[model samples]
Target: MVNISSCECMPWYVGVFRIRQRLTEEHWFDANCKYYTHVFDKTIISQVLGAIKYLSTIPKYEKCAKWLNENKQNLSQYFLEGFKSSKPLEVLIHGDCWTNNLLFKYNSKNTPVDLRLVDLQVSRLASPGSDINYFVYTSLTGDTRSKYFHDLLEAYYQSFSKVLILSRRKLPFTFKELEDDVERTKIVGLVIGLLAIPGIFFEGEDEIFDFGEMTEENMEEIFH
Candidate 1:
């Protein structure tokens, strides 16, 4: 069973959200744009679309694939510009909150007693929902997520509330607002899963293409 308390730690440092402006201008925008351009030479978008098309052929991913296909155009826009739409209740989030990026500590009985997040390189200001959605979608099985979605949200909010009370601070937003934010930004999870989960699970011995050797010419070959 996935421990819900593992997610409670996300909102512990509310002060991090206050530094959004400097981080956005000095770090996220520059790094994100340069990453999309210079790293993949602007071919990452096409590769993502190709990956989505490939995913649509998988039986287990049919529903997710349908949603990805339907919203692909918006997803392309979000790839670079999603930060612009951050809500007023935004917080500094673990920008890459997938399964591999999280670490859990188990007690003597092997029950997860603690959690730690890794890879702070991509951390940025965004809705707490962004992290929640990404982690829930990418880490949990669909049935698990469907069963415990509300419980997870409740646990997260309770944790956030306890932290705020201990820090003598006001609740930044109501639970309803959090739910709305999660609803609005659910696409962040789906889009990220579409781009990442395939590569993580790919077991083919063939080298897809070296990032160092990537070019517009060979980028399309990744989907083949």
Candidate 2:
């Protein structure tokens, strides 16, 4: 596998403006809309917003809910700019690292022996932790993530460290630093999961929603 942590060069065509447009305009939020707008499916946007609004009602997440509500308009912009603000270690990352984008090949014994990542359109230069956080939060169950979070970090660090050594590149960051990066970039995972997971399961043509029919009350019901 390539030592992604050490690789610095990106394609000549990939520029900051393109990354900004992808993050701000094409993917999550529509810049033209005054309110928070999801670019892909309006129904999915409603569900995500409804979920956020629902969370705000709960006492425990009040602070989180408050922050999200206060910053809803700027959330997409924040996500785009966050890469530049706190990146101690940078690497080319598979921007969308969810389970569906991954394909695994199994041996005769039914054990997986090989892996491939698809959907390169969103790939960009960013912290390696962004990919890790996105994968674990979106792909794995909450229970699994909570229990094996540290173990997962350790495994990734060991593998990455080995690759760097083999390639004669100095290790860029310590294991602790990796953990910190993961923690710092975790909102990327959470935001993505909230936005994308609903659309993943609502696949049937019959389940398609009429955007005109959506309202505050029914939106929460749809999310539930």
Candidate 3:
């Protein structure tokens, strides 16, 4: 059974988690913008807020956040950084990429591989690395987090171009320019996703097993 609270949701991250699987294909063709029969669940959101706080306390996440804070003023600067770097080749990003639900039929022919992202729930306008980071973080876990973060980030920057340095990106005055946004964003996104742990998605019948018991403490964590 897939546990939602163990997954990602925050800054509307829960939307991706709450998305009903049956509609994934339809939404994919629509460029990933899909809403739901339900709105954000306060109970689920509570758990997420608490989780973000708890996960942020972990050293792996903290080290990443600390580095971000030391350089750029905050996380939002990433959007601008990406917009400036790309070769006018922007496409919708599968904003959430912890798992790739879409299946592909591979051909042995030496043709360019064109990926069709199956779930469009998290798809939104963003840079190349947006989907890339999600895949790498979830695909690689544990020590993989330690070893490949920098290398993966560097590759993404290189894929964009030589002059598109993250250093030129703008950020809040409270923070300075950071040397690396991709690396910092990668870990931060993953941790915050766990922090905003989403509610479970179920097919029907108000499955009791799907939802974890909601406590007032968890609620306070979310809206706080």
For each candidate, the alpha-carbon lDDT, in order, equals 0.64, 0.60, 0.39
lDDT of 3 at 86: 38
Any runs in candidate 3 off by more than 4 Å, and if so which? 1-45, 49-91, 102-116, 157-179, 183-192, 195-224
RMSD to the hidden true structure, all candidates: 4.4, 8.7, 12.7
Ranking by lDDT: 1, 2, 3
Best of the candidates, lDDT? 1
In TM-score terms, candidate 1 sits at 0.74
Tens-digit lDDT track for model 1 on 37-122? 44432344565667667877888988766765666555655644434344457677777877687677778886666567788787
* TM-score preference between candidates 1 and 3, better one: 1
Residue range 110-223, candidate 2, lDDT tens digits: 655556667978766667667777777777777777766787677667766666676576777798887888778877776677676766779696776675776766655654
Candidate 3: Cα lDDT at 70: 51
- Model 2, global lDDT: 0.60
Q: Pick the candidate with the highest TM-score.
A: 1
In model 2, what is the error at residue 82, expressed in angstroms? 3.6
TM-score of each: 0.74, 0.67, 0.38
Q: Please, what are the lDDT tens digits per residue for candidate 3 over residues 1-224? A: 11222221121232222232223422233311222101133332343445556658887787654554454322233322442223233334556555445333335773323333456555555434445555554555556656655555444334333222233432221111122334444544543344333433335665333235544455444344
Candidate 3 lDDT for residue 182: 48
